[model samples]
Target: MPPVTLKDVAQHAGVSHQTVSNVLNGHPHIRPTTKERVLASIAALDYYPNQAAKALREARTTTVCCVFYGHNPEDISDPYRNLVQSAFIAEAQAHGYSITTAFVNDDADLTQLRQRFLQREFGGAVIVGTVLTPSQVHTFQAWEMPVVLFDHALPSTTNVTADYPEGMAALVQHHVLQGRRRLALIIPEQDLGSTSIRRREGFLQTCARAGVEGAVYDGTWSYDAGYRAMQALWAGESRPDAVLGGNDRIGAGALRAAHDLGLRVPEDVSISGFDDFEFAQFTTPSLTTVHIPHGDMARQAVRGLISLIDGTESESRVFPLSLVVRESA
Candidate 1:
């Protein structure tokens, strides 16, 4: 079927397209009955305004796409993503641009995304929160529009990311200060993505310099995986004295697993996590974590992506990470 246009909406509402536009623009002169008719027609037609023209006739209203990715639908709904998204939207609107959000979970979803982008009215897109696998990188390279990868670094693309290794170094040294001689990192399986590699590099390098043992454990980025990894580590004869969770969710799970095993945190094993998620402070012991400045990241990334869209080059940005020490570790 052909794409629905403003004319379709006007026809469905039995009004002129000008009347539909007036109602959409909130002209205030239109009667309540006319506005309701237009809205109902829009819903019935499944009509989406040309995003660049959505509710604004001004030339400043550039529509930018924000694409979020995850391993699954649930992961896409993660709080971390929400943090970034809220910030991203606010920052975009600050510069007079309209924002639309999209999700890409796996390669299969790429087809739908491609269809939208092919006919898209947007100028540029900001792809954030996704693990940039090689295939993903390759696929993104094919896109003709400007894109900025947020929190995930891609040598082939402009990136606005965090200093993960630096963050991990701070975390590791904190553990070492408490006389922790052995450390282990529980994170998602290794990938070429900057988050995974930089985190490991920081943990291992810091541990080696501190003359402490640091091991890496692989798992899904989920609470269940963290729980199982912790259980397996405890089952071993020589488990690390300090456990570092890749993110707060994993750390929360590890904390629970330790409690269930009748082990006292910090007494048996000290734990730390990343991403100072809201739940971090509310955890039983209150999780110690590294804070990713989601707002700052969003601000920087949106500015950078928009710059690139305006025929200017934007260098990648890396924001420093901070550690929030709490009772957890």
Candidate 2:
């Protein structure tokens, strides 16, 4: 992309191109009235006088920041975040750029990230596998660089995400049709970002529409977390006949929890999940799940970010989700 040229100021100022330059450089003895015309022209174009602005256009724009939020240091190893990031890295490498992992765990980390990137060392960023509170969102927006969000959406930003509501609705409808009136869901104790919230809301809405009793359990995005939630949900005498996991990993954990509690699969309680991960079909009874195309989303995010970095047109896109039925459900 080319920077605005002297022709821009000349178009309105009707002065020699050097006249605008003289005005900007604070040349002495220029008519104050004439200088104001060039100044006004610069302001109208929203041109930045800082060298950073110029360096931005001159920079190679070949590096991409890969940012993911971690609640704790251990969350840096989150499988879901890793898989999604790996996909982005692969695509970014294919596009002749390197991906730099940015682990953001707290406000201090976030502030440092924003400052470091403001140096324009990275062309843009792809933020995935995290929740952004309103303040966090503002921090990211302050980067003043192209960005693509995965599994989340924000105004004025490009986003690539699977249609969570569609997938959750399919899962809910499938369970309700099986005569499972008492359904329960296990989701991250946190909002888990827009995608997770969308799934939760979709389940609730679909359940209400189906006139079935639906309950939700707070759990993290792991099999162990799912296991604990299942244990707690089933401990009560009034148990749900069907349960949904936030993801396949959680579903697998829930399956084990049922077995440990002397319960049968499907026969005792139907189990299903989102993110039909590769091992879903290999689970005990196989796991029924919503297949979110994370790979496709990552590819789209990379493409969109590249387009923005190159000063081309890029629009946000939403991918549809599909439900995969297996024995577990």
Candidate 3:
């Protein structure tokens, strides 16, 4: 069958195409009875609005693009990425908007991505998990497109981020309350950006207040990195009684390392991580970590982007983080 169009609904409702368009666009000029008739015809025919044509008529794209750097097949396979992306997709669909995803790799030129935005005419953009270099951020600013950043922060751009500092602080205080004195933190390399830095600051501040010396091991944000960091901690002159993994993946690795080293979790050394990924619960000892609420963050990002697209004003909002206590800690 041919694609259903406004003409079909108009003919079925015995009204002009303009009248059908008016009703669909919520124009007040259309009579109540005519509106009902047109709506009934639309339902009977299973007519759907042509989003592309609607956008063209309105002079807006009505589509949004989500860009992530360092995200690939491997990254998407991770539970954390799936959670965040699923939330974003559901939220975007609720607003009658479409989402397109793009990946930026180390050797790939960003100009290609920029060209895509121009070709597709995306109404707005949301960038997730990408650390924007200063120059790159300047380029985005110059584009003057409505943009929102998630899971990271950038200068002069609207962003929705988890309360990393407070989350880490709560994790640290929890261990201290559990009577664990010496604390160690396994963090990703410094250049990964503000999220890690804020988490580290929170950990350090909480440890200082408790009068405990905090040791920090800098490494990548991966299971292998977490395993190596734990090994190095054990080899050190003094071992921390508790360890904080930057995220759930790191925390899971730390738990495995503890088991391999003949250390009983919470008995020999307690471990906690951030971002309660799905695997956190299935670990040998369930992970005690901070839950960043990916769904809420995605909802907020969508709300903010809708406001931006609709020319509405919005204030910057930060979602609160909660500590999930489980067996590992």
Q: What is the C-alpha local distance difference test score of candidate 2? A: 0.81
Off by over 4 Å in 3: 1-58, 106-108
lDDT per residue (tens digit) for residues 105-208 in model 3: 64223444554454455767777764677677666556556677887776666788888889998999999998999999998757567788888899999999
Q: What TM-score, computed on C-alpha atoms, does each candidate reach?
A: 0.77, 0.79, 0.78
lDDT of 3 at 214: 92
Reference-based lDDT, each prediction: 0.81, 0.81, 0.79
What's the TM for model 2?
0.79
lDDT of 2 by residue, 30-67 (tens): 89778767777765664544446657546766889887
lDDT of 2 at 299: 84
Least accurate stretch of 10 residues (summed lDDT) in model 2?
107-116
Best candidate (score: TM-score): 2
Model 3 CA lDDT for position 95: 88
The runs of at least 3 residues in candidate 1 whose Cα sits more than 4 Å from the true structure, single-residue gaps closed, are 1-61, 105-108, 133-142
Listed per model in order, the count of residue pairs whose N, CA or C atoms clash below 3 Å is 0, 0, 0
lDDT of 1: 0.81
